[model samples]
Target: MTILVTGATGTVGRHVVRHLLDHGRRVRALTRHPARAALPAGVEVAEGDLTSAAGLEAAFDGVTAAHLITFGGDYRPLDNGPRIVELAERAGVRRVTVLGGWREGTLEPALRASRLEWTFLQPVQFMANALTDWAGPLRATGRVREPYGDRKSPPIDEHDIGAVAATVLTRDGHAGRSYHLTGPEVLTARAMVAILAEATGRDLRFDELTPDQVRREWVAEGRRPDLSLFRAFSEVDGAGQADLVEMLLRLYGTPNELATTVTGDVERVTGRPPRTFAQWAADHAHHFQP
Candidate 1:
């Protein structure tokens, strides 16, 4: 089966491609700049756009399924996801998996309304996102300054997200399912700092800042991120994103014969356990070092 993976070079999409290729499936990776797409050797790289459907004619050709990322350009997944899925259906494709959010327009509604079998992957938060808080400063001073020191969350590993996507794309019985995926443990920023410190054998500090201080710092750094997004980072109702984190812990202990947790889902689908935050840090130590 030829699977076309959009956002083929991103954190999640690269894993999707790698997982598919590891399973011996034919893969076609889509990117705007084909020259820059550093895909695996056997996979085909096609130049395409998810915004206007201008360069996607050949992308869907002979593709039996597709992994769709909601962004391409202008963040118009509402306009483009259906068009691409329509093209896939026209080419007799059977499955479509979407990496949810990260797009301006809603692609879920369009996917649900289509005839194609589909799965939505909504991870609560990526552990890799934590790297943004620490990696830059770690390279400079081995310390991270951020707001809400006690905030905790169940962060999903990006590789696990990819494994689940590969399962939904390649196998059967996953259609019409929306998976709220997350990690096995709920960890605080301080707790994770300790983990990284342990892994790298360096003293890493999590300096707690007030929300106002964080926003001012970001503004000073020339990154005016949306206030709501920043607020979500600091919002701690006892456990910081606790509602979703609790749901994840509830799902984690369930039988593997039933619904999936972050780790079990990746293991069940990929035949490998999900990488932990420490493992991720160890693997990416170069990115954290001076």
Candidate 2:
């Protein structure tokens, strides 16, 4: 079966493509820059924009299932989501796996309304997001500073997210399911800083800052960002950040205060255990240090 994968170059999507290729499935990867796509041999690369369905016809042709990332481009899911689903349905695509973020958005609801077999993969926060956590400051000054040094989350590995997506895309029984993919541990920012310090053998400090301070730093980085998303970090409503620690602990299989879950779910699906945070840090330590 030919599977169409959008966001084929993204952190999670890239792993999906590689795993699909490894499984001997026909993959038609969708990207705006086909030439730049370093897809595996035998995978077909289709140049298209998810924002405009006009270029997607050839990509969806003869595809049986698909994987999609919500932020196609320009973040206009209202305009592009339904069209993409409509085209997939018309092309006789039976199953779709949507990789989603935690925030409320148009794409999630739209996919819920579609007639196709759809599975939503909602990861709390990516382990990769922690790149922003320590990479820059470590490079500049060997310090990772942010607010909520004690606030913990079940930050997942992107490859695990891809493994879940591949399972949903390639198999049955996953339709209408929304998997809250997360790491096997709830790690605080301070704890993570220590992990990095041990991994890199460098003295790393986790500096806590106020919400306003984070906003100012982010603004100074480049263009202005949506403050609500950043503010959501500090605004620990019961349903949001406050619940994250509990949710992650539940997903990761940790109890008490220190025992972390080390499940084989990733290996079960993709023939590998999910990479640990320390392993991730070690591999990416250069990115964190310099």
Give the runs in model 1 whose Cα sits over 4 Å from its true position.
Answer: 73-78, 102-104, 220-273
Candidate 2 wrongly placed segments (more than 4 Å): 74-78, 102-104, 211-273
Q: Compose the digit string of candidate 1's lDDT tens values, residues 154-213.
A: 677898898899888888988998776777776776888888888778877877766556
How far is 262's C-alpha from truth in model 2 (Å)? 11
**Per-prediction TM-score to the true structure, in the order listed:** 0.81, 0.79
CA lDDT of each prediction against the hidden true structure:
0.72, 0.71
Model 2 C-alpha lDDT per residue in residues 1-290, reported as the tens digit of each score: 99999999877889899878877899999999988988778888999987777778888999999998776444333346777878888899999988774344566677788889998876666777667545766877887655567766666788788877887788777788766666777777688888989888888888876655644554444423332234333323444433433343343333333223334445554555566677777877777766
Tell me how far the alpha carbon of residue 100 in candidate 1 is from the true structure, in angstroms, after superposition.
Answer: 0.3
Q: In lDDT terms, how accurate is model 2?
A: 0.71
- The total number of steric clashes, by the backbone 3 Å criterion, in model 1 comes to 0
